[model samples]
Target: MRIAVLMTNTDESDFSNSWPKDGEKFPAMMRRVRPEWEYVVYSVKDGVFPEVLTGIEGVLITGSPHSVNSGDAWVERLFGLIREIYAAGIPMFGACFGHQAIAKALGGDVAANPKGWVFGLVEKRFADGRSLPLYASHSEQVTKMPKGAEVIASGPDCDVAGFVMGRGVMTTQYHPEMEPAFIAALVEHLADELPSDVTERARASLVKEADMQAMAERIALFIEGQSA
Candidate 1:
């Protein structure tokens, strides 16, 4: 599969520089499931995008530190590109901020969590009764589902933890690309920004293993036109 990875992260901190970028992080996780797949990355945060989508088989939007509601020019352009991609009937998957952006771009709503930030490992319960542990790091969520979108997963803090629109689009509020060690490092990096209790709890949650491979397989299946 040839996929277009839209990297939306804009962090320039020392921690960000020390770690693998979203472009690298996402492909690393995905290549585990589809070793033969090829990825083309675009730093959409910097206003970079493909001039045409002629050969792109799939699109994957990575998480970003910026919010979808930020009203930036590049964000608006990305939304326009998302609509164009949907109109062209290409399969797309988005994580975290990407998730919120897809929802908002498709006539849904996103807002700050009433209960505040939901960080660390979280268990998402699907309607099929399957639960998966995934790492989360976001302050906002999809408060309203887009028309025709189905809620596939939910968690205690987020009602729309994951959703799907037809066969071509899927999104998740959590970060499956993020591993335990990465989340640990992220929590430490944000120690001064996050609440003490939240940081402590996030640290405590790392002991539980995340279902990264399972989520990756599910995403891969969806993008490949199979039931995920």
Candidate 2:
């Protein structure tokens, strides 16, 4: 499958240099399940996007530090592209900021989390009663579901941890592409920015393994138009 990745991360901190680029994280994780797939990345944060959508089987939007409500020109353009993709019946998946963007673009709402920042690993209970642990690092969330969207997962801290719109679009408020080591490093790197208690608890939660492989497989299946 040929997937177009819209990378929106704009972090240039020293910490980012120690890890793989944001554009590479999703492909690295998805490759475990789809090694034969091809991925092309566009730095949407810098106003870059695919010139043509022909032959693109799927589009994956990566997490970003920027908020969807930032009102930047590129952000608005990305939203327009999202609408175009949806209208064309192309499969799309989003994570974190990408999740919020999808919701807002589809007539939903997003706002700051009333319960405060949800960092580290969180156990999400799905509508089908399946529970899975996933890494989270966000202060904002989707406050309203768009028309025709179904809430797939929810947690105590986040009402809409995951959602799906029809068979073409899926989103997660948490980061399944993030590994334990990467999240651990991120927690420490942003220790000064976040509350000390949050960092401490995030560190403690790392002891339990996240269901990354399972989530990765599910994403691959969804992108392939199979039962996920």
State the lDDT of candidate 2 residue by residue for 170-224, as single tens digits.
Answer: 9999899898889998999899998889899888989987888888888899988
Lowest summed lDDT across 10 adjacent residues in model 2 is found at 13-22
**Per-residue lDDT value at 46 in model 2:** 91
Name the regions of candidate 1 deviating beyond 4 angstroms.
none
Question: Which pairs clash inside model 2?
Answer: none
- Cα deviation of 24, candidate 2, in Å: 0.8
- Native-vs-model 2 lDDT? 0.91
**CA lDDT, every model vs. true structure:** 0.92, 0.91
Q: What TM-scores do the predictions have?
A: 0.98, 0.98
Q: Write the per-residue lDDT of candidate 1 for residues 1-228, one digit (tens) a residue.
A: 899999999998888998999999999999889989999999999989999999999999999889999999999999999999988999999999899999999989999999888899999899899999999999899998889899999986899999999987899999999978889999998999989998998899889968889999999999999988
